[model samples]
Target: MARNRYSFLVKLPTAIALIAAADQLFLGTAIGSWIGALALGWILALLLSRPALRRRPSLVALAVAAGFTGVLAHAPSLLGWVLFWSALSIAALMPRIGRFDDAWRWGLRLLAHAMTGPLAPLLDGIRLFRARPRRGRPSSSGLAALLVLPLAMTGLFLALFASANPLIARGLTQVSLPSSFSVIFWALVLLVVWPSLRPTRWATRIVARMPSADIELPGLPQATLLLSLILFNAVFALQNGLDLAFLWSGAALPEGVTLADYAHRGAYPLIATALLAGLFVLVALKPGSASAANPAIRRLVVLWVAQNLLLVASSILRTLDYVEAYSLTGFRIAALAWMGLVAIGLVLICWRMLAGRSAAWLINANALMAALALGAASVVDLDASAAAWNVRHAREVGGRGVELDLCYLSWTGPSSLLSLIELERRPLPPRFRDRVRYVRAEVLETLVRRQADWRSWTWRNQRRLDTARRLLGANPPAPAATWPGTHRECDGWIRDDPAPEPAPSVTSESDPVANAVATTTPPLTGTPSR
Candidate 1:
């Protein structure tokens, strides 16, 4: 019995390490840390697996102490390791204490068995909740209600502060948000804890039916895509503080004002553009009635065309007024054209629904158009505002010839750089290959070494810096001269340059390549790109 117990104890850590390796390969280093934590838990469980250890109150206390100590000792691995040990310890203790029935133990064992596979979805759900708690259920609703009062009060105070002193408002606008965003964050916590609070059969059935097949008809892939688009758009908008409107009444603007200021000034036009795009999508997908004999379809098409014309007119006006740039050139035009195709597809779908034509084709077309519209909207919005500060600063740093000495990059900072055109194209020195410089290397390494240290130092320090900057009305750093020069007309700078005529605006709808491809494609598909 002693030999068999010894053998089990020896094998447990190896098994945990193997699991950790697998998690690292697929789930990433952070998860590997968690697995290490879990391994520690497993070891604790093994030690407590002995009947003698279980029977002794002192040993049990020692086991718990050791588990926590291991977490602290492997400070970087605390979360994963702690969770892993806690789970195993709980598993072991459950049967020993005789609190959980055999069935409950078996259920838990089964859950543990499938834990890794379910982890991604679990994390994704957590992420979704963190992003948009308002979209989720009542468990999150309570947290939202609690937060709403404070946020409301804070917003009101900030508004009053800004109203009384515009500079204070400007400074307040710069305040860095909490590292963990509020709405989505609480939502994630709720999602994780939600299972425990899950309702009885009747309530479960009602709630389950709420997100039925029809309502979530597009399916998981499309749903995931939509969720991603919405989250990206919201994050982009919020990061830029795109809603702040200054009373322009001919106030002298400060020199070297940041793009944030520009975005704030043109917030209405930007929002209007987004709304118009959404409307265009809606119009393009309007349905028709059977008894109407295509009259409703024709009318809907006419209305859609009219609306498109109006949007185009408004966009042109906004562009001319300099309220918004005609940055809506490439993908924006394609989006409008895609909407037109969708309108046609919608008419065809309605005709099919009315005249007993194939529903499959209609479904396929609608799904395709929906995907295109979604993809287009996401790309365009991200591109339009992608050049915001964090990335712009990083680019300036690199462009100004600063060397990057980091291994891992901050997910946020690198992503921001990727959003901008100039920075993305500007090649970095080969020395920094595969290395992203966002957070300093020391900070990232320390966080990896001591996971909770992030909470103590870097995160706290950055948050404080951000808060101070906001309070002091510190503006984002200026874009380097070389950075802006990179975007200027390269063709004109050639040694044997032709005499310059008035260059066409970048937003013009004259892509010869697009037109050529459109002509070659079968009319049934509308365009090759489509």
Candidate 2:
């Protein structure tokens, strides 16, 4: 049997040279920048040539050379490091290379063939220039177009920005703009003046010396549960939008405020519920035919359970005013209820996992349960919050407060916070509760701000507003504020006067460890810092 050898020299070396030249000419000679650029280029080349590299040693050599050049040319400082490591690695691989059989050699050849594309053109150019007369005129059009493209694109982007947004116009005008014609002209000149370099002949000669091989592996099931969950969530969102559109048509609610506002605010609970429900369905369906005895199945089940439990705990904490804590104005109570349902789902899943029977069926059941729980929780939170917040804000700010309140609701946009807000409306949808009581300090502050800014806002309803102002003033919002723009503006108006700071770092002798440990022997690391 004959062997094929692939040439990697031209492609690899040229790529490295091009990258090095580009970095030196444009980006400057910082060692770190050059090294980073070279590494990036090498990774790209490897990714691009992966299919071919698996088969041919010559191609691998070309790739390695290209990578090395890229590093050495761009980052000369790294040359020593690269050389040291390369020598060591080559020595380590020498034994393996020597022992490789005909099959492995064939595999290397296949890889070299795969990597030919990136190298072929450059090699062809090299050959062409080597034979051509130095003074002969060459076509410059292609080179000119390549150079002009980036500049043209950048100019168009700037033009569009200036036309669309007046705010950035001054900034745009201040920056130096490249001349498109000049760029194109320079590119053309380079194309005509530069020598042609070809790597194809070399590549062909090298590929001819390489060998070939065949390999196979058993089939494994690809998980589709994540995709299914995404699809389910999208559908739920669309449905929620339609429901809000219908509900807003009624005259009794605040004008222009739709159910979507509630949906956005309550997003956390909504997603949590949907995920839980999806898990239940997945557990129930047990889509793959793979047996429970499979280690993969066991691992997946464990992961699914753990993820659900974490999600459940987080959702519960959020509802109870721990994480993502907001005022309990709207569907906060409904969020709590949804969390309870999720808790129940978690319990059911744990039961199944412990029972250690019908693992597939139980897993599918868990998925279905998770999906339902998440879906119900999200919908409920959205409805309850929107209704309660809308009505409360409206009444607090007097009748004239409706429009601005509606605008505020709109400004919140299609986010989780809005969804939770909508969850508390009455004539409670079947299998859904209407009222919830728990409210966090943050949620209260938000409502207070809305009420204070209401179009019809007056000093008469200043009780809660006053209270919120005092609380916020005492806390003096952390330097890192979350909601900027309007929220921040609102906070400024509502927060009370700043308080004096307490002394720092004083430790009392009455502290538990201090009192007990001091009475005993000395501590392991020495006395605590004052």
lDDT of each structure? Answer: 0.39, 0.42
Number of the top-ranking candidate, with lDDT as the measure: 2
lDDT of 1 at 401: 22
TM-score of candidate 2 relative to the true fold: 0.20
Inter-residue clash pairs, candidate 1: 34-80, 37-80, 37-81, 38-81, 38-84, 41-85, 130-184, 130-185, 131-184
List ranges where model 1 is wrong by over 4 Å. Answer: 1-200, 203-530
Error of 2 at 159 (Å): 88
Per-residue lDDT tens digits for candidate 1, residues 348-413, read: 544544455433445455555654554344333232232342234442344332222121123222
Best by TM-score: 1
Model 1, residue 275: distance off in Å is 5.6
- Model 1's alpha-carbon lDDT is 0.39
Which parts of model 2 have CA positions greater than 4 angstroms off?
Answer: 1-289, 322-326, 350-530
How many clashes show up per model?
Answer: 9, 105
